[model samples]
Target: MCGIAGKTGIPVENIQPITDSLHHRGPEGSGYYADNTLQLFHTRLAIQDLSDAGAQPMQDESKRYVLIYNGEIYNHTALRNKLPEISFRSHSDTETLLHLLIRYGTDILEELNGIFAFAFYDRGEQQLILARDRFGVKPLYFRDELPNAFSFASELKTLRLLSSSPLSVRTESMLECLMLQYNLTETSGFREIERLGPGKFITIDMRSQRRQTVSWARPLYTRQYTVQTEADWIDQLDTALQQSMQRQLLSDKPVSFFLSGGVDSSLLAGLTKRLYPGRQLDAYSVKAGAAFVQEGFADDYAHAVSFAQQIQCRLHTVNAQPDLIHDLDRIIYALEELQADPACFFVSDIAARAKDAGQDVLIGGTGADDLFSGYRRHQALYYYNALDNIPAGLRKAGGALLKMLPAGKVRRLQKLLRLSLAPPNERMLQSFLWINRSEAMNLFSADLREQLTLDTIDTYCAGLLAAIPEEHDPLNQMLQLETHCFLAAHNLNYLDKIGMAHGVEIRVPYLDTELAKLSALLPPQLKMKGSETKYLLKKVASRYVPEHIIKRPKTGFGAPIRSWLQEDAAFRENLRERVMQVCSQWPEYFDRQQVERFYNDTINNRTDGAYTLFALAAIESWLRQFTAN
Candidate 1:
């Protein structure tokens, strides 16, 4: 894994400063390749080959083709085995990609099973090809409007350093950041740059400054629902997951795992020990402390210790308790974009501890929930599908009846009733959105509300749903939507950014292209199996993970945000003061009174929303850190 920054037109005289900004991503080695046409800057972490032989901006003997890349190519050895005639200089994926691009051109991207973002320059052709991996596990941000230049980098802030333009916020992006807690679209928080879409490549003509963008791959949600027996399907899934695990383990440094006390991470840890026998493994598990237990989180650390004992792996426990007040700003700044996931602090802590322990590569179970059926939202889909069979009038009546009832202890039921009656597309949007339209409009200033239409949210939600192959099945549509949109935009973005901040390469074996393809063909029934989420995956996991671990209720990498805001007076007052003070300064986007009301509602249990406040407060941190330039 590494950090790459480059420009296709006039060479920036001082690319080193912009390059230095990404030093945290790759601290081991640094290099640059410059010419009349372009400049490429690279900071290397040296995952595959720790020698200078693996240093990049690597080129072949002819020096005709140069590359500055980030991310790991798991199948590089297999790709190299195919190019027998070309004797290689060093054992590195960088070299392998160079030769492959020479032999097969951009066509080689289809066959590469890795998470990466790269800039491959063809000096002879005077073109720079920038590409991101299939699911965008690695981020590539670029700006085309720069003066006589097209710049790209691993993080948006790196590109900001390359130009003199002020990083003003885009109104739509602000809405996205606050509502969704991250920018879900390709357009970033800043109007000046855009994130390269997953499975996409942009080729720039150095001479004319012309650029052509093409999408090379998209996840095809076939929803084939193949007629295979349950037992046979289980065996196939095991083989596929095991194969991916083997491929992702290709690294020179020691590999570790994150046992997040969830089914996904637990199963991956089990597979790691079972498939790679005789290899001692280290697993990092987060133990939510007693305070968290009091605030409703389970003692998952105990679960992790029990499972690790059975698997004979060393377990290292990290406190899930984070100093939300101080850590939030630091994490949001490190993220380079606005994100409100409290898990970022936890991820950062684990990465620092693991890196200190001589572990460079950490295996995580990120894509399991997106690929297979998991999450309460998926359960909601199950109920929605059953409701679809009933008469529309009855559904409307049910929703109306629930609305008439007071906001009593049956609040959860009220949400389900309203959710069940929503139109198909609205249902999908409701499942993901932080607040309803009325509430969102109340928070925004009048002019801001007029400029931004709620329809944009509807369109984005509908766009993902429209891509579903099995349109009739709500569960299948949601599963595919999560796989294509939410998984990369939200989950993987935070994981990659936060993990790389501590120079740790976080690998997701479940997101292996091959494994994801298999997941697409799975019958929706098998994925959710009546009320049980990830039923088929759980069956396959039974071989490696204990039955007790598999049966545990679903939980995530979480802190008790609601409780923290309600019970801890000092912390609550601190955050409330911070957000109110920030909002008072930014009246163009927010109604200060409404923002205060929102906070009061959440703190008093009138609304279940800690994330909404976090997202708003993160805006101040991000603006202060990123927009000063």
Candidate 2:
């Protein structure tokens, strides 16, 4: 609910622009506090308290600590009961967090539960502590310079504004982005800025200019229920989700829900309706034009509308027209990178329209898929279990053979074969094998590739493996990796940038801390029963939504990029020319012939190269806009 930026060794005048760049994140008010050694700036969204007391940078009663915090502390009341000795100055949760940290030291992170990214300056200790939530619901970026200089902010752009270095692409991260369409911890398209990993707490000493990072929040995955049945699992999930939703609904301003007519969003909408029947909540969904190209699936606008009507909430359907695509450049600029797919453009538009309507909070069902195994690829586990009888060599050979078939069929077969051969905990990572390391290398210029270390992929994968327990079941290990790495680094990163771009707050109930811990305790079979994914979620959802709604095939909230590339001559031409122009400048890294082949296939409708092409287009635009200058 706020934007914060600061630096050591920088004048207050130099740091003001850094904070100004994030004005959209906090438009209600702004403040700055600085001395010769440090400067801290805050932009207030004014969600918790409209009074002056809620204003930040707020300090402790003794003024020993000053803080700039983003996110809500849902359990502040509970925490206050434990520390009755501390005099409460404001009703705002921000003050509670500052006092909690003062009382409990860094242990405050483990005691309270909420989505947040905050910086606390201990004037007494002469240190700056930066922390992000366990699930990474909020974004925090920092740049460290040797020997006592550091800068931190809510967005990379803020840090970019203050950094002395030029904006250059991190080739290893770019390669990872091109290959997997995502990057691991602390890496970004920009080499100069790094993201703080989820569950990480770091302290920077102002005196020595040194920093130390330690894990403050840990996911406890011990299976505690020896006698828990499927029915018990459903009941627990239902209760947790209901409680999370109720708590997240606390807002001084109006709250809305993004309805996709799927089980996840539909269930959220149904719950909100049941909780506050008197308040007609706003439900928003996208209504794409009839002429819009269909990628692999048809549009589900009608289903969303039907469900909205069923819930009796006020529905607002924003139409997606050709003109919307024209605004992609602006959206990409706001996001600071083009790595996000076309789906982001649609979601950004939704947030923009919601902001214009004066709505501040938007509840989304983003974590439901990752948490409940809602993806079609989750079926690979069952297929792999059945194929356990096959030899590893045969499965590898079969997988290579299947890659020659039609892309869609080949993708499914490859997933099954990989699952069969890979360790169970690794199947989730393997499922994301859209582009391989070789493909990534081929896409970049030789000079860029040489600038990057060869061990980047190994280092990233090894970090993931290190997080899993040696005795953990393969499926459980895979889930843990997905939650920590993929969900934390990529999915949540995307949501934070897009949602904050329009000053709209997004709350994910499925990722509620206690709920996630409870689900982690349930057996994996309860999560994915046989070929069915999210079996327990579906069972719990049955209580609120109809059978038909829960039974519908998964319809991803994404754009029809394949059809767009084939049919929209202007978009295709502009995208191809831009990519070629960008790559031409770095001839040593990319093969022009290979780039042309992808462009030709996409433009000529030879294949569904939209996903790959989109990734390339985003990278090209980002390079041209941020680096080429």
Per-prediction TM-score to the true structure, in the order listed: 0.95, 0.93
Candidate 2 per-residue C-alpha lDDT over 1-629 given as tens digits, one digit per residue, 9 for 90 to 100: 98888888755465557667989889888988887678888888877777889899988878889999999887787889878898887788898998888888888788667889899999877999999998888888888865667888888778877675566667766666665666775677777788888888899888888899988877545545335777877787888888888878877888898887788988998877877778787988888664442444446677788877877878888876534345656665766643645667667878888899999888988887777777666777677778898888988899787766655325556667867776754565667655555555666666666676656755676676666545255455556666766677667776777888888888888888787777777777777889888888899889888787888777666666655566777776766766686578767657687778766754654433567766776666666667766
Q: Can you list the residue pairs that collide in candidate 1?
A: none
Alpha carbon lDDT of residue 498, candidate 2?
A: 82
How do the residues 1-629 of candidate 1 rate in per-residue lDDT, one tens digit apiece?
Answer: 99999876656777668768889899998999989888889999999888998999999888999988898888999898879999988888888988998888789998999999999999998888999998889999999864467888998878887754566677786777667777764777787788998889998888788888998886457556677999999999999999999999999999999986667888888887888779898999888877666655677888889888888889998977688878877788778777777888888999999999989889998888888978888888778778778887887787667655543324556666678778776777778766567776777888898888667666766776665645567677887667656787888888898988999999999989899888878888899988899999999989888887799887766677777787789888878877886677778888899999988888766666577788778887777677655
Question: What range of 10 consecutive residues in model 1 has the weakest lDDT sum?
Answer: 403-412
Model 2: per-residue Cα lDDT at residue 620? 65
Q: Cα lDDT for residue 443, model 2?
A: 65
lDDT of each: 0.82, 0.75
